[model samples]
Target chain A: MEALIEEPGTADTTWESRLEAKALIPGTSTGVAFKLWVGGLLLVLLVGIVAYVNQYNNGLYVTGMRDRISWGIYIAAFVFFAGISMAGTLMSAILRITRATWRTPITRVAEAITVMGLITAGVFVIVDMGQPLRLYQMYLNGNWQSPLMWDMMAITVYLTSSVVYLLVPMIPDLAFFRDRLPGRVPHVQSWMYGTLSFGWIENPPQRRALAKAVAILTVLIIPVAVSVHTVLSFVFSTTVRVSWNSTSFGFFFVAGAIFSGVAVLIIVFAIVRRRYHLEEYITERQFTYLGYLLAAMSMIMIYTNATEFITKGFKASDDDLFAFRELFATKFAPLFWFYFFGGLVLPVLIVAFKRTRTITGLVVASSFAVVAMFIERYFIVVAGMSVPLMPYEPSSYMPTATEWAIVAGGFALFMLFLTLFTRLFPIVAIWEMKEEHETRVEVAP
Target chain B: MIVDLRHCDGCQSQGTAPQCTLATIEGHLLPEPMEWIEVYESPLEGGGTQFVPTPCQQCQNPPCVNVCPVAATFSAPEGVVLIDQDRCIGCRMCMAACPYDRRFFNWGSPPVPPEALLADYSMEHQVQAKVGTVTKCDFCVDMVRAGSLPHCVAGCPQGAIYYGDLEEDLATNGKTLVSFKDFTTNNNAYRLKEELGTHPRVWYIPGHGEAVGRDPHTTGRMPTKWPWIERAKGAVTWKR
Candidate 1:
C-alpha cells in the first residue's frame, strides 16, 4: 500500500547523469519509516528465537508434526526460500548470458537477493532437524544414495558459486567506491572498501580478465541453481509414497522455482526502487519485461499442474487417488484452489493484460504469486504426508504456535537481511554507473 | 519371519499370555504409538476376516536404510536393518521412505524404568531409546544371534509365526520345525506389497483375523495400546 504513490515514470532527467551522481553515493536514508521497519523485524526475530528455544526444550512434540506426518511448515519454508533463491541468480545469469544490455540497473540487486535467499533457505534446513547438532555426521558419514545429500552438495556448490558470482561483478564497483567514497564514508569503511577493491588498475588486460571471469560465472551459475532445486525435488519424489513419487517432479520443481523466483525478484525490485527513488534508472520498461517473463512462467505452472494431475490421477493408485482427493476436494481444497486460481490464473491475467502491466499491478500480482507459491509448497508437503501409507487412519498436521513463531522468525530474518544488504554496499551497480558516466562525458563535452 | 495368519489369533495365548506386542512393550518400555510388533485386521475377498501379526519386514533393499541421510540405519551382515542411535540426527527421512511405515520416532524422553535405564545401550539391540532418534523392530537380532527365537515367535500359542534361516533351509514355530523353502512354497505365502520391489524378508499367508477369534461383522483393526504414555488430556491430536 505504501507503493500506491505514483512514480514519476518518465522523469525528464536522463539516467546517465542521475546514475553517475546517485549510483556510487551510499544511501544513509533513515527516518520514522525505516526505524519502524527495523523495529518490527527485530521484535519478530526476538519472538521467533524465544519460540524456537521453547521448542528445543520441549522437542518437536510442541509442533503440529507427528509420526504419521513427519515433515511440516519448516521443510516447506525451506523449499520456498530455496526456490526464491534460485530465481535471482538464474535470471541474472540468463540475462547476462543472453546479452541483455538493459540489465545494468538490477543485476547487483538480483545477486544480493540470491545471497540472502540461499542463507535463509539453508538456515531453515538446520532448523527443521530434530538433532541439529548431529549435522556434522552428514559430513563424516554422508550417504551418497540419499537425495538429501544431493541437496546438501547442490546447495553448498550453489551458495559458494553465488557468492563468487556476486563478488565478481562488484570488483570494479569496489574500486569505484574505494576511489570515490573516501570523503563520503567513515574511515574504517573506506579502508574496508580499499581492501576489497583487489588492486584493479583498470588496464585493458585486467578489465578483460574481470569480464571473462564474470562471463564464466554467469554461465556456470544457472545449472547449479537449477540442480539445487531439482535435487531438492528428489527428496520428495524419491520416496515410495505414490503421492510424492512422480517422473515430472524434476521438471515441475525447476519450472516452479523459476516461476516463483521471478515473483520474488519482482517484489525485491519494487522495494529497492521505491525506497531509494531509483525511478530514473529502474524505469517502467524493466518492470514490463519482467511482467512478460512472469506471464510466461505462470502459463508453464498451469501446464505443469495439469500434467501432474493427469498422469498421477489416471494411474488409479489408491494412495495417489487418496492424496489427490485430499488436495483437490477434501481438507486441502481451499489451498489447492488458491494455488490454482490466485497463483496461476490471476498472475497470468494480471501480467498478460497490457493496461494492467503497470508497476502497481505487477507488484500486486507478484505479491499474489509469492504467497500462493508458498501455499503450493505447503500443500505438497502437508497434504502429501497426510495420507497413510498402510491404509491406517489418515493423519493431519496443524503447526502449533511454536511452528508459526519460527516461520515468522524466518520471514523476519529474510526482511532483515534484505534491509541490511541495501545499506552495507551500494545497491546500485556502480561499475555500470561508471560506464554510463564515462560514456556521457565522452558524448556531451 | 513368516506369519501364517490362517492359524494365529490377535491376542495372547489363553493359558501362557506371551503375545509379541506385550513382550515387546515389557522389554523395551516404548512410549505411545511405538508398538514394535502389532496386529492389524487384514480383510478377505469373502465375508470372513483374519488378523495379521505385523512386524518389520526387514527388507534386503530396506528403504529406511537407503534413505537415511546420516547413514544412521545400516544393514547388518545377518540381513537385519539396525539403526545407530549414536549417529542418528533424527531427520525422519527414513520414516517417509518406508512404504510399510514401520519406523517410529521418539517424540520426547521415552518412559523407561530405572532398571531399564541401567542396561547398556546397544545399536544391535536398541536397548536405550533416545528422545529424537528413530526406532523400530530390529527382528530381535541380538536374540537371533544368541541362537534363540524372537519373543513374538516363541510366544504365539497357535505356532503360526515362524522364525527361519533361509541359508540353512530350516524354520520353526516353537512346536513345529519345517523346511523354510518348502513351508513358503507349499502354503503359497507371499510378501506384502510385492509390487514395491522391496524384496522383503518376511512373508505371509493372508486371512481374516478369525483364526485369533475375530468376528468379521464387528471386529475391524486390532486395537493397539501404548501403556507407558497417557492419552491426550487436553488438546487432542487428530489421528485418522
Candidate 2:
C-alpha cells in the first residue's frame, strides 16, 4: 500500500503535482471514518423516509401546516436550498470568466455543491406537496402563465446546464484516473472513469474544444442562475399578500441567494480543505476572498431589506401595518432579529475585522450566515402567511416533528451526495491546477 | 350575490349559529373549519361590531385562477372561479393567491357524512370532497341553474343575501325580486378590495345590523359546528 502511493511532485516537478496523489487518495481508499459517516447519513435518510411515509398516508395534517398558514418549513427549506445552489454555479462561472487563477482549486467543489443543492431543493418541493403522485401534472397540464410553472421550467434548465458545466471541464481528470489507477480501483470505478473520460488525450485540439465548451457554459449559466432565483421570488412576489407584494423581490431574492450561496461555499471549502488534507492546495487565500464576497453580499442584503421595509412602511396600509407588526414586534420578531443581527451583521463584522479574518473565523461567520439565511427563508414563508387576510386574528404555524425529520433528511441527503462523489471522483480539477501552475512557473523566471 | 350588511344580525336574533354558514355546510357536507360562507364579526370605525358573511367573490379576474400551476382551478364562462379537484396537484398556490381567505384545503380525508359519497361529483357542487385538494364557495352554480336559490340565500332568516344575475339585471333574496342594477346603485353597494383589481362579483351594502333591530355593540356570534361529523366513518377533521 505504501509503495502504491506516488512521490510528491514526481510527474511534473511542480507544487500542483505534489497535491495530485493526495487528491486521488480519498477516491482510492475507504476508511472506517468514511463508512461511519455514510452510515449516519443513511440512518437519517431512513428516518426521513419513515416520516414522509406517515405524511403520505395521513396527508399534510401530519405536519403543522393548516389552511391559514398553509406553507411551513418545507417551502422554506426549498427556498434555502435553492438559494444556496446559486453561489456555487455563479462563483464558478464568474471566476472562470474573469480568468481567476485561484479559482482552479475550488471550482469543482463549488459545482458539486450546486448540483446536490439543486437536487435537494427539488426534493423539498415534492415533500411539501399534499399530492406528490400528481407531480407529473406539472408537465402534462402546466399553466405557462403561473410563476410556479416558470420556476419549474427555470429549475429544469438550470439543473441540466449545471450538470453539463460541472462535467465538461472534468473530462481530462477522469482520463487521468482511468490511466493512473486502473489496477488499484474496483471494476465499476475503473469502468466509470474510462466511460466518462470520452477518450480524452489532453491534446491541443481537445483542450481548445473543452475551453470553448467551458466558455459558452460560463457565460450561459449566469443568466440561468439569475433567472432561477428571480422566478423563485416571483412565487412570492406575484401573490397578493402584503409582505410578498413587492416589485423589488426579484433583485432581493437574487442577492439573498448569492449571499447564502457564498457562505455555504466558504463553509464547504473549509471542511473539504481540512478533512481531505489538501491545505497546500486550498489555502487561506480562498477563504479570505470568499469571506469578502460574503461580507459584500451581507451589505447588499442589508440595503435591500432596509429599502423594502422603509418603502413599504412609508405608506403603511392597514394590512401592511399588520405585516410590519408581525415581522418587527410580534410573533416573528425573534427570528427576524436573530437573522438580521446574528446571521447578516455578525458575518460582516467577522470579515471586516483584521483580528478575526482567519480561516476559522471565516468558517464561523459562514456558519452563522447559513443558519441565518435559513431562518430568513422560514420567517418569510411563515410570517408572510401569518398576516391575517381578513379582519380575523392572525394565524400561527410551528413545524411538527415530522417536518423537522424530513428537513434533517434533506440535509443528510446533500451530505451523502458530496460524500459519495468524493469517493468516486477527484474533488479538485487536477489538470486545471497543473495548467495554472505551469503558467505561473513560466512567468516567475 | 349581494349581502345587505344592514339586515345581517349574524343569525343572532334567531338565537342560533349563523344560519347561512350552517346551511352551506349541511348542503355541501363540508368538513370542519371550512365555513364556505363564513360570517366575520368586524369592528366598526366608530365603536361597534358588524357581521360580514363572506362567500367566494367569484372574481372575474381572480388571482387564484391566474396562479394555479396546473390550470386545475379556472374561471368559468359565467365568471365563477371553480377548481377541478381531480386535476389539482394540491400545491396551494391558489390558496396563497386568494386575498379573501375564502379557499379551504382538505388536509386529511374530510369528515363528510357517508351519504355525501353517493352523490355524483361536480365542480359546481364539490360533493365528496377529496383529500389534498382545494375547495371553496363555488356560488352554488348548480342550484342557480336549477332555478332555486343558493342555500345561504334561502337560509338567511333576515333575507339579507340576494342571489342575482347581472346579465339578466335581476336578483332575489327569497322574499322579493328586484333589479340588480337599481338595488346596487340606490343602496350604495361596494365590493371588497376593489383596488386589487379582482373585480369581485359579490357586493355589500354597508351597515351595522340596523335593519334587523340589533345594536351594533353585540360582539360575539355562535361558533360554527359540523353536526354530521359525529356519524362520519373513516374520516378525520383538522383545525384551521
Superposed Cα deviation of residue A80, candidate 1 (Å): 0.5
* DockQ metric, candidate 2: 0.85
- Candidate 1 residue pairs in clash (backbone atoms < 3 Å): A393-B240, B9-B212, B49-B208, B49-B209, B50-B208, B50-B209, B51-B209
Q: What are the chain A TM-scores for all the models, listed individually?
A: 0.93, 0.97
Every candidate's chain B TM-score: 0.87, 0.98
- Residue-level lDDT tens digits of model 1 in A1-445: 2222112552444554456456553343356888899999999999999998887766677788888898999999999998888777766798877867577788888888788888888888887787888999999999998889899999999999998988878887777667766765679887977888789768999889998998888888888988898999999998888778888888888888888888988888898888887887788988888888888999999998898899878887878888888888999999999888998899889988888989999999999999999999998898888888774678778988999999999999998998877865777886765675677689996
For candidate 2, the docking band is high
lDDT scores of the candidates, listed in order: 0.80, 0.91
DockQ of each: 0.61, 0.85
Measured over all alpha carbons after superposition, the RMSD of each candidate to the real structure, in angstroms, is 4.3, 1.4
Return the lDDT, model 1, position B59.
94
